[model samples]
Target: MAPLRPFLARVEAKTLLAVLLTAAALWTFVGLADEVAEGDTHAFDESLLLALRSPTDISDPLGSPAIETAVRDVTALGGVTVLTFVTLSVMGALAIRRHGRSALFLGVAVAGGQALSHFSKTFFDRPRPDLVPHGTEFVSTSFPSGHSMMAAVTWLTLAVMLARAEPRRRMKVYWIALAALVAVAVGVSRVYLGVHWPSDVLAGWTLGAAWALLCLLAARWLSRRGDIEPERGGP
Candidate 1:
């Protein structure tokens, strides 16, 4: 039988890139947090606020009602809850189908990201925006948005899983693109709705991506160790 040369090569490259990116993200996140601690408030957060408050001389063609509705919907469920639930549920289903190892990896990755988000919020205790009307009421500390983090982690994790499933080449690319779009859209929505500062969303995405990559690497290691067998008709 011929070896799956292309498949193996892709996996090696993906894993290496994931690790490098994850490390870079962590370094950037730490540096940003330190800057914020040193009272650097002129970052993306302030800029985003300015953009939101900028006058729209020309009325939005979509109208205020449409914009408001979209904002309300996006901020309805906090990003954390929505992403966590979706990722966990999908992982759980996969586990039940005998892909226990992959599921475990997913679970750990999400949990780690959540923990980091919570800790960062507590550490920074950054206040929520009061300059604009918030579409939804929330009381969590707001440095790094939980919703943004979850959205990134969940969608990125799914993308990694899809890539590993050995699906059709075109389909794999489509899935990865779709997941990336959703993750970005969710983060942007949080900012547009005045629920999270732009900096918060940016930080969330960085941490989320880092966590997902770490999780994928861990999952790959487990698979090699015979700890996580691919499911029948998997991916």
Candidate 2:
């Protein structure tokens, strides 16, 4: 076998470094969660409470009724439901249109990430915080918040798909940034409404981001293997 080129070696090193960093962060988060579970909730829970309390005085000009209504509407199944359905539908449609092995890889990546999120939630089984009034009733386990995880996974997946679909750098940045902002907002909302602890949100973010990266890597690998063609249309 021939020796690898210097540039290729550097690229491989950088990729390995990134994977290591991600793994370390994930391990740290898991350890933090474990510590919190052992009655050291001061670290994450207290910080979140302080942050949420600071914004309490900033009144929503619309009043409690309007605020509640808006929150309810946003958090309602219908709001994100439509977005989710539309995104997945488009991905499926595109995959069929492409009809390649790469599409199979993309499909698995997206679906597997979703399944992993659900599995993680069930494994954690941590309860939601009762410190503040919950705006919406929820019954799921709290650690690694479902809303936060799902938001990150879905939006990030869409962002990846959008990036792959387009070649313009500016458009790619805009699409990814918008998706990221929405995901972060949804995660923050969970804490603000007292439905999830800060640790839950943090874990959700860390794991969700890692999962998205993994999915993107899978897509890239498939593309390299000539299993799927790069999307040429504007996203």
Candidate 3:
């Protein structure tokens, strides 16, 4: 019991940090949403959106054609098709590794995020930015970018799950960093392509991250109750 004290203390500290971080993210999202509804973010969004495009030609994005193409590719990583494929693949892998419960949890988390995105977009009914020509196609309202939201949801959720399974601290850090890089890239690409306002991406990122953290907290609680696999150690 004495030897276990330090490890338990570390777990408690990490859990507390996760809770605080999740709360902060949620608060930020709510604040952004309120500001957006009040039209306070229009100037900020337009400035950032225009900065990424040529002053002479709003239709032309700044940078070489290749860079624009690359950004489009990155943006696609957040699209529904790509996100769905990646989530399915990860779930399949988890199932194969006999982590079926984890896979189910991931499926539910991703699906719930999708539903949240759909409902929020419908409720807000915000229009996409028209300051510049859209560089890519969009099929939904753009208050909170669906692509950016799903990018964070899928990538971060996967990262948290994978990190839990990894024994090495460095590997855990690597996974989280990589996931964050992907999510940020996707959000930036949305803004760069003129498909979404900067506030839209910001809101998407915050809300998505908050949702992912909530799922993580739930998973930890479930694990503690022996409702899910312990993975590397008991929660």
Candidate 4:
């Protein structure tokens, strides 16, 4: 019993951090939403969105055509088709590994995140940036960039699962950091493409991160109760 005290302490600390981070993300989202609703972010959004384009010609993006192409490729990582493929592939792998429960959980988390993004866009009904020509096509209203939110949700959820399957703390951090990097890149791409305001990307990143953390916490709780498989070599 005494030997397990340190392990329990570590678990508690991690859980507390997750909770605090989730709360912070949610709070930030609310603040951003309020600012957007009140049009307070208009100046900031326009300046940043315009900065990505050529000063003399707003139609052309700042970089060479190659860079623009590369950015478009990166942005595609968050597109519906790409994200859906990645999600299905990961779920399939999990099921094949005999972790059907985790696969189902992954599907639920991603689907819920998608629905949240969709409904939020509909609710806000914010127009896409009109400051410059949009470099890509878009269909939904653009309060929260769907690409940014889903990138975070899908990649981060997968990262959490990958981290769970590993026992090394360093590896866990690596997976999560990589996921965050990808999410950030996707969000920035939305702005660079002039399809979404900077605030829209910010809102998406925060809300998506909050959702992913909530799912991670839920998975931990379920694992503790033996409702799901525990992390590798975890108590």
Candidate 5:
């Protein structure tokens, strides 16, 4: 009798599926961003960005004062200070746990994403949105919102790592979903704040998600091959 083949559980299958879906999204957004950079998507991008604001008052955001305050607080979650602290803290924990490979991967993935964000801004030289006053100041080009990209990279990267230690499939789903929620909120805040075009945030989300998936897939493969510390179990 032939030996039975190994059957992947739902979680394992979903992880592989996520890589494929994220890749497609990454390519789709790359094309859109290129269209934006070429000035082909300006009408669409501007319309979407403006739609999120008050129709009568361009300077005013659509939300009430309290909601606006909440949004600003959420947006701050994607800021450099917050993301950096979170990254360092998570990496420190991983290192202390003797998962050096995970720590290295997290550091490399985030740092590389930051470098890519900077290079992309320079390469595109796209100006910030000017149809309305910006709620937040910008120091770099606006092709891809740095806050959005780094937020996605940081949250999604952490989500993937943290999810692996989850023994239950539902918990894994929740972790990834929570990460996606934060990333989406950050991107929306950039547009709401009148700092980035819709396409810029979309590009950031897709690219950052892609980068996170790449890191996760690499880590998984390495662990299987005994090149890194395998997941020790528990969240």
Candidate 6:
């Protein structure tokens, strides 16, 4: 109890909050995954899938073609090629700015997330929803939507990077809000396209959010320990 005080003293309130939130989200994801695997979520997943589609035709989606095309574009924002390009581009920018630590951090955070997403899919081995015709082609197991995870990772990572450089509180808020919107859009697009179960997107969101927050917490700790520079103006 006495030694706990010293450790607790070193952690900031916000860091502690992030840790708690991350734990809560991660546990939620785990619970959902277990239930999904046990088939408890089958009824709910199918119901939600049907509710989001045209009542008359599962093949025909709910939106206009133009809107469907727009959703595809949004979903593409989380596609492998797009995320890879965005990751390299942002890391390149960080390196050019001489924020080597930040560049490395971003690289590991995203790459790790990709690997984790893959591992989760393989582990769960959940098939994609077949109740409707898929709007986009995909080639992976589907317990968790990869697009949803990547969207959260890329957008949230960029949001943190940009927010750190912002001095104004509102600017930081704006970046975070915009990032959340994009992430949510990607998840919704997955369900709308009939490529993923609603639970898959929920799991992806929870896992991705937890992972991003964990990375942020690591960045904060490393900055304090002089292992990495803070993102005050640099990385």
RMSD of each: 5.7, 4.5, 4.0, 3.9, 4.1, 2.1
lDDT, candidate 6, 76-133, per-residue tens: 9889899888888888877787777888888888999899899989999998988888
Off by over 4 Å in 1: 1-11, 54-63, 76-81, 92-97, 230-235
User: What C-alpha lDDT values do all the predictions have?
Assistant: 0.71, 0.68, 0.89, 0.91, 0.83, 0.87
Task: Give the range of the ten consecutive residues with the poorest summed lDDT in model 5.
Answer: 1-10
Give the Å shift of residue 62 in candidate 5: 1.4
Residue 142 local lDDT, model 5: 90
lDDT of 6 at 166: 59
Q: Quick one: RMSD of model 1?
A: 5.7
Query: Which candidate gets the maximum lDDT versus the true structure?
Result: 4
Instruction: State in Å the error of residue 150, model 3.
Output: 0.8
Query: In model 6, where do residues sit more than 4 Å from their true spots?
Result: 1-6, 233-235
For model 5, the stretches where C-alpha displacement exceeds 4 angstroms are 1-19, 232-235
How far off is residue 196 in model 4, in Å? 0.3
Per-residue error at 41 for model 6, in Å?
A: 1.0
TM-score (C-alpha) between model 3 and the true structure: 0.93
Model 5 lDDT tens row, 125-208: 889999999887678889888889888989999888767655687887898999999999999999998889988888888888
What digit string (tens of lDDT, one per residue) describes model 4 on residues 1-235? 9998887777787798899999999999999999999999999998998888888898999899999999999999999999999889988987887778888889999999999999999999999888888899999999899999999999999989877877888898898999999999999999999999999999999999999999999999988898777888442
Per-residue lDDT for 146 in model 1?
A: 77
Per-candidate TM-score against the hidden true structure = 0.80, 0.78, 0.93, 0.93, 0.87, 0.93
Candidate 4 TM-score to native: 0.93
Model 2 alpha-carbon drift over 4 Å, by segment: 1-21, 50-64, 76-80, 92-106, 231-235
Give the per-residue lDDT of model 3 (tens digit) for 5-95.
Answer: 8877877777888889999998998999999999999899989999998989989999999999999999999988889998999889878
Clashing pairs in model 2, backbone N/Cα/C closer than 3 A: none
